[model samples]
Target: MVTRQRLRRRNIGILALLLAGLVCFGVVEGVALPRQDQMEAQYNAAQNSPLTHDIARTSHYATRYMGNASKVTGLFRSLPLGPIRSFALDPDVFTVQVNLDASAPMAEIDRDRAYLYSATAAFAYIDNLEAVIFNEGSVAYRVTREGLLTWYGLDGFAALTADSAVWKTEVQDKLAEQDYARRAFQELFRESKTLSV
Candidate 1:
């Protein structure tokens, strides 16, 4: 049988440990983490985001790269078919029509594929194009385009970290704003956790 005095001491020791733990957790989560998250957020707000800028710049460069593809691999006998067939961006919807000459040359199709793959890497390049021989006895291709900004924003979010309520709110706001961008990413991501072209 344990004495009352020893039982009291044991309770006091456990209480003391619990109090210390609470204090340490409070300091780390409430005090230290908030300040750090705020400082980082401030720094990010002031300077251009490396991720966004890089992605934007990449989008720009990729567009240019695709534009000049025909010169390197040779022009398709006709227009290039977009990969996207249809895109529904909530209030907005984009429908594409692609009618490229398939008989132009096999090499031309290969080059176009390279352009599509590269742009798709940076943006939402669709590939629903189908090779069809029209009633006129001619071959044609169709392509489509989709939201690209969403991918850019998601790629950016991967670099940010936070542990404060304020910073967490800020992150939420930024993500919300990204939804309104030309290419709605949140919806797309919600539909597919891991996006792929």
Candidate 2:
């Protein structure tokens, strides 16, 4: 019973409404979803990355050593090889050097001394893993009597060899922790997205 013009108008109205809905959906998705996905991807990449973890840990230890003069010596002594562990994993990527002043304060001297011990222990640790310590200084310094004396004096080597099993266990534990953190972050991210919606 409708006139032709009326039917045409109704069809045009329906088409316009559909077009508006499509534009609204597109605008919301284009503005929001891509940005959210990008952010999540970046967060996941950083959180799950071993290099990132290593850099963070190295920075943390370095900051701790630099900030706390009272505890620096004891902490360094406790983790003699910790300074070089991150670098040891990729010799080709890193060039490490230790410059120590014999006339410095006891704390400074202890820190440098600890670093030297770490360098030595790192050499041994990498060598044990069948990787060559290509740094000439690393190779040459360890051959001298002073180096030998330092090696014999510290319990670093003994600890490294004796606690090899513990090191593996610790790595596994760290992986588990990372996994847990990643899951928690993912849950939080999902919650944030839901809240935003």
Candidate 3:
């Protein structure tokens, strides 16, 4: 009788432990796994965003010892805007003629973001770059290295070499927000000469 009682008790304890293990496995699979997947998706989307890509690309080039004017052309092409028709790189200023549809002009805010991001990337990569001008046929926006650095309130635009999280907070994420981008655009380009090309 005693032996039978002991065996029954041992079996019950083993069954309880197995049930507990199953519960833990269910929680991890049903709840934790989905949460982790959702977070991963959001991160991937942010990293793949156009703005993020531009920032990351510029950051990558900045790590190089020297950068050329071709990098600037590459930067403009990477923007969401239409293709570049032609570009003339002076000793200090780089002018880009972009092909845009007259019927469907880019939005003002979008133009600002594109120009600002491009200038930011240019100044970051090209060490001797002074200014960048984007000509949309009708008008042109000139962004100077001095003006952009001043607007960003940084003595040197070391944002390119900053840690990923810091760069995102200071540049990438801010440019993604319309209000912040507009404010930066106005601050950097307000005094710029917008001449008819």
Q: Best candidate per TM-score, number?
A: 3
Clashes of each: 6, 0, 0
TM-score of 1: 0.26
RMSD of 3: 6.9
Per-candidate Cα lDDT values, in order, are: 0.32, 0.35, 0.64
**Model 1 ranges with Cα > 4 A deviation:** 49-197
Write model 2 residue lDDT over 109-191, tens digit each, in one string.
Answer: 33333333343333333222211121222221222223433534543343433454543333223333544434422322111
- Ten residues in sequence with the least summed lDDT for candidate 2: 188-197
Total residue pair clashes for candidate 3: 0
Best-to-worst TM-score order: 3, 1, 2
Q: How displaced is residue 21 in candidate 2, in Å? A: 3.0
**Candidate 3 TM-score over all chains jointly:** 0.60
Deviation in angstroms for 120 in model 2? 26
The residue-by-residue lDDT of candidate 3 on 64-176, one tens digit each, is 22235565566556655544666655652344333444455667777666667667766766666666666666766677889888877888776554565666566666777
